[model samples]
Target: MKIRLWLIMAIMLAAIVLAATGCGATTGPSTIVTSQQNTGVWVSGQGKVTAVPDVAILTLGVQVQESSVAQAQSEAAAAMNAVTKALGDKGVAGKDIQTQRFTIYPIMRWDESKLQEVLVGYRVENSITAKIRKVDDTGSVIDAVVTAGGNFTVINGLSFTIDDPTDLLGQARELAMKDARNKASQLASEGGVKLGAPLYINESGGFIPIIQVPIARPGIGTPPS
Candidate 1:
């Protein structure tokens, strides 16, 4: 069986009621209510829906250290090149693989005799983020990169998400609207006032839900998730 992540979401909804005592007026998120309306009712509703994740994003990189910056960078470059090749061979499209970070810095060590920090070596770090459309192949894709990079491979992060949430969002939106209207109807019944159509709809936008699987950096050659 393959690993799967659940995407949970909430949609925002508001129902506006026009008061009969007030003259016709218009404001944000509410339609114009005329003097015939007796009361303004504002209510919020939420909708929750679950979706199965179909996409995986992996953040991995190569880190190497040597006596000089050139040596360190050369080795890192070679390793990164091999890693990218492996990714391509594993069906990852070239466009989906992107470099996220590339850094070169000096390594330091404490020296008692010098009474200061001594320059030990230089390190090169090259990281990339890969978007895997096939969720089931994520583990295999990671394995390929690790094998290609050898000991310099480091896994920074991994997460799962939905590719297209339009359908799910539509479902949530319907549920939310229904919830809002129901609440408004109940309020009107209690207040003994006529219920009116929604004057305003507020949309707060949406975000992709993520499931992060924590994994430690075990270096290349070690098994990856």
Candidate 2:
């Protein structure tokens, strides 16, 4: 009887250990499942609008060299003033003329023999951007400035663009939205699903075409020392 009792106690202890450890449980090692619910389809669309530019932008300037910084700056200022008067003569409004850049720096020549840089003279550059409403007058305005500013005149670059781009941007936005709607509808048809109303909308950007003007280097005689 004592042997039988010991055997029963051993069986009971094994049952208690299995219950504590959950050995017979079917639940796998605490598995976690993640799922992304499909909400809607995403589509991207683009639109472009182009038109001939009505305004011309020119970067005109005068650069002068002198032995002293004050002298160079004075000469540059005089030349730039003359250029501004020339623009005014061509009917460019005061609001349309803006000083773009003005700089004064010492001219340094690299001396290869001495392995150093030698100061030659002070160079002053004064520049302004003029928006010409009359695109056809671009050449005449440039010529007039050159004549007025004389030997220090410099024509940096020219570009053509529309004065106002609001209308163009609006048209492009409408077209882009239409394109997106059409694409979404097509996708919904192919996938055998109903397209829901747009819950969100975003505009990437509008395209503006730039008309590159040929670089024209104006001839300016050497500055008087």
Best by lDDT: 1
What lDDT score belongs to each candidate, Candidate 1 first? 0.78, 0.68
Clashes per model (N, Cα, C within 3 A)? 10, 0
Error of 2 at 113 (Å): 9.5
32 Cα displacement, candidate 2 (Å): 25
RMSD (Å) of each candidate, 1 decimal = 4.8, 25.3
Over 4 Å off, model 2: 1-37, 110-117, 219-225
Q: Supply the TM-score for candidate 1.
A: 0.86
Off by over 4 Å in 1: 14-38, 220-225
State how far residue 195 of model 1 sits from its true place (Å).
1.4
Model 2, 141-187: lDDT tens digits are 88899999988899988877778877777766666666777777677
For candidate 2, list the clashing residue pairs, or say none.
Answer: none
